[model samples]
Target: MKNLFLCSSFFDVAGILPNFLERINSNCIQTVSFIDIASHVEEYKEYVEKAKLAFEQQSLKLEVIDFNQSSDDIVQQLQKNDLIYISGGNTFYLLQMLNEKKLTNVIVDLINYGKPYIGESAGSVLLSENIEYIKKMDNPQNAPNLKNYKSLNIIDFYPVPHFENQPFKNLVEQVISEYGESLPLIAFDNKQALWVLDKTIILKDET
Candidate 1:
């Protein structure tokens, strides 16, 4: 019952998701909690707008829960949502917040219970065993004192998001040289998605 649709860019990929809707129980994703950590550096209006449009286009009712409040408050709110979507952003900061809030275990519990979860960009990177891949794409100084750098370990391969784009693309070689030897790395852009259902893994992208 493990279902995941780790996407690169929700709006950027556009019509691609409708194809995978059937796998998500056809429940219309009624309530949602969007972890908006990635867009922390910018206004959230755009991300929310795009997400709203995407849900509407799919004929799904989405009630986005605000997660910027206290960890206790967030956790309480989380119980109301049927879906959890982590948006792309500063991975280090995102993980830092999750740990600092002590909300990591709750998320682990939720996902382990077979709740559908979606991750994009930095969100996708956190699904690996470790966030060492963030060394190349994001700055750890935001959470430099972070002691536990371990990721969710839900997936085995490291998803090097933003394969051919700026900033992130520049560090691909370095990330590969450092971790690619032991850890498997799969590079993807805004147009791709990694679909996971228990033991089966599929890459949804343009061939």
Candidate 2:
């Protein structure tokens, strides 16, 4: 069964994370594989620090993994962790690194095997079958080496993170207005999340 918690912003929904973990009977999670390769800029680095603190508050030891610098074994690193967290950043860059490192299949297999996976923003979008839908919201120029917009394909519906939220509000609306009829978009705000448990899916609101 696939256990996925897709969120617009991890900090926005961090308080309710424990409840979700409880619902999935994963309260015992101790170690997490924090994938923050998407956050390459100085500004995003600050957000990553807060994300690390969030995990620390839950008493979850995090093994931060950066595909850009680390030469470690991806499969072994992920397999050793109790949970997998993909932070928010440039969607194109994130996909480019994952594709370059060939970690997409590894992550998909682990999640399918029941490993709890948490995705924030870009992370959430990467689970969709194709990431081309988010081109308007995220700059594709960040990933010049990307061969295609294909993604993990773990979920059938396209996730529109930060829906109706600032900065991305207009962009999100544009994406919906253009792809609403052509794509299966599951749009949600920062305080909401898309929970996927096996074949059952639910849109959870923290408001």
Give the number of the best model, judged by lDDT. 2
- Per-candidate clash tally: 1, 0
What TM value does model 1 have?
0.86
Tens digits of per-residue lDDT, candidate 1, 1-207, equal 667777767777646665655666645666667777656754433754686677678665565545456878888767767777888777888888788788778887787788778887777888888897668777787676578789788887888877776655778677877877888998777788888877788888843
TM-score each candidate.
Answer: 0.86, 0.95
In model 2, the clashing pairs are: none
Model 1 Cα shift for residue 54 (angstroms) = 2.3
lDDT of 2: 0.89
CA displacement after TM-score superposition, residue 141 of candidate 1 (Å): 0.6
lDDT of 2 by residue, 141-205 (tens): 99999999989999989999999899889999999999999999999998998899988888888
TM-score: which candidate is best?
A: 2
Scored against the true structure, residue 40 in model 1 reaches a CA lDDT of 76
